[model samples]
Target chain A: MRDAFHDELNALNDRLMQMTNLVRSAISRATTALLDADLQLAESVISQDAEVNRLYAEIETSIYELMATQQPVAVDLRTAITALRMGADLERMGDLAEHVAKIARMRHPVSAIPVEVRDTIVEMGQIAERLVTKTGSCIATRDVDLAKELEDDDDAMDRLHRRLFRVLLSKDWPHGIEPAVDITLIGRYYERYADHAVRVARDVVYLVTGSREFDDSAS
Target chain B: MRDAFHDELNALNDRLMQMTNLVRSAISRATTALLDADLQLAESVISQDAEVNRLYAEIETSIYELMATQQPVAVDLRTAITALRMGADLERMGDLAEHVAKIARMRHPVSAIPVEVRDTIVEMGQIAERLVTKTGSCIATRDVDLAKELEDDDDAMDRLHRRLFRVLLSKDWPHGIEPAVDITLIGRYYERYADHAVRVARDVVYLVTGSREFDDSAS
Candidate 1:
């Protein structure tokens, strides 16, 4: 039974890795669409959201079944619970990507953002992608050190986020209020993505450390 | 042990209800300050945030201890887990109120938003406060039906949010970018508050139904 549970756990992690990779691609494609005003990629992200949502449901059911049937205790319990929380985080990350894609579609033929804003958006995408990648890797290896590094990465994202806002508020901003709104919402989406990534990392840490070492303080 | 666990659970719920009330009042005061340009109220909300954070930590530690000691299963496990998640949702709600309050301070002698925008903000506040109140009641009584009603209230908040954005985007808007940024962030804070309320309601539904229902489809 324990060996079977181990296999089930590995299967769960595999599903999570797949979801993380898909969400990363969605984020990348969504950013590309936003930066280039590519309607096709934007539409693709939106259409792909259903698959992400379905995966979320499937993972939720599987995790619950594992818990119920295995009655897992100790490390096994932690692993199952972490998987459940990570699934939610990944799903929300997907939702954030979908949101960015929707914004991309809204921009359509004419870009609402200035070139500077586009640059910030792309950097935000890269940072978010890195966080998501780290989260997936940490889950695969149960690397607490990697999880801690992801926590630090979020601090840098926070600094960049603040800088992005400062640029928005600068006196020389071009294209007026619409760009400001776009930039603000875009910053929020990236910040949220980073947040969920941090959450996944923290769950990894908790699974290994057996301590609630980080919480709101990490944010 | 089970009886003691229930007592501790009740105490935790009581603390949570108190926090919810504080957050609800904070949101109300913050919104009032926003509309009335009352800087003092915003300042008070910001200062009071530490208390909320402290209570959150205390509740979290209590939940952790319970889980570590009791090794609770099934309904007891769900209840404790739900309490911890509820504390988190409430803490974020407090933080949102703090953000709104900060916005109030940012616009000290608050920026003169148009009457239409002010009305929408006021309405948004009312909805947020009601959701807080109803969700708190749901927690205290374990009333799933009332929790469902709060979910409906969240839908109302969404509608108001969309309407506010539409008004902001309307061609005749006279305001430039600053008010636009403020409105955009304020909308996000309210939207997040609604999201948390919906989360609390979903947890209640799960407790009542003992079923894993995903928010993606229901919402």
Candidate 2:
């Protein structure tokens, strides 16, 4: 029974990793589509979202079954629960990618946003992808150190987001208010993507250390 | 044993409700602080955040104790897990309120943000407060219908967000990019607050229905 449980758990992790890869690619393509005005690429991101959604549904069902049948205890329970949360994060990332794609379709061509802003957003997207990749590794290997590194990487993304806004609010901002607003929203999406990645990293840390490190505040 | 287990679960729910009420007040006060640019009110929101954080830490510790001691199965485990998730959401809502307080400090005594825009944000804040309040009631009573209603309320907030963006992006946008960015980020904070409330509601739905109404792909 223990061996069977391990095998099933591995299978579940494999599915989560696959979903993570899809989310990462969707984000990448969506960013590229936004920069290049590739409506086809944007549409593809939109189309692929259903797959991510379907995978999440399947993963949730599998998780529920695993919990019911295997009755995971202690660390195994944490692992399963973390995967469930990670699945949710990945699915939401997919949704953000879809939103980016939809925006790309809406704007199309010459782009209301400036190239410099788009470049910064693309850079933020790369950072978000790295965060997701590190998080996936942390889960698959149960590496607490790798997860901690993702947390630090999130700081970098946060800095980029601040910089993005600074640029949006600069006097020389060329594309006017619409583009500034668009880029700022895009920056927020990237920032939120990184935030969710850090959340998954925190869960991974908790899974391995059995200690959650969130900051405490008084009510 | 079962009776004691149920009692403890109820206690946990009661504490979560308390945290929800605290978060609701934080948002409301944060809104007042923003509208009035009252340093006293902003300081209050900032000071009150520690309380929310402490409550979250306490609840998390209590949850760990319950899991370690009770070894709850199935639905009971789900309840503990949902509590953990909801605690995180409330903590985030508090953080967002604090963010608004910071905004108040940065743009005090007369925000460049237009009166109309400020009113729209205040409305969004009110909606977020209602979402949390309804969420508290739904979780305490396990009212799935009330949970669904909160989901509908999120849809209304989304509409408000879109309208806010439309006005900011219109040809006659007067406050320039800085105020527009401020408005967008604040809208995002409220939107995310609503999103987490919907997440808590979905958890309630899952707890009661054994099937999730909203997954990660949900808006």
Highest lDDT: give the candidate number: 1
| Candidate 2 Cα misplacement greater than 4 A, ranges | A214-219, B213-217
State the DockQ, from 0 to 1, for candidate 2.
0.48
Q: Compared with the true structure, what per-residue lDDT tens digits does model 2 show for residues A1-219? A: 778888988887888888888988988898888888889999999999999999888887787777667777777777777777778778888888888888788889755357667667777878988988887787788888787788678888888888888787778877777777777778877777777777777777787788775512211
Q: Chain B alone: TM-score in each candidate?
A: 0.95, 0.94
**TM agreement with the true structure for every prediction:** 0.91, 0.92
Number of residue pairs clashing in candidate 2, backbone atoms closer than 3 angstroms, sequence gap of 3 or more or interchain: 8
Q: How high is the TM-score of chain A in each model?
A: 0.95, 0.92
Tens digits of per-residue lDDT for model 1 on B1-219?
988999998898889888988898899998888888898888999999889899998997787677667767777877877777778788888988998888888888944356768888888999999999888888888887887787688889999999888888888878877788889989989988888877877787787788655454422
lDDT of 2 at A96: 84
lDDT of each: 0.83, 0.80
Q: Spell out the clash pairs found in candidate 1.
A: none
Q: Interface RMSD value for candidate 1, one decimal?
A: 2.7
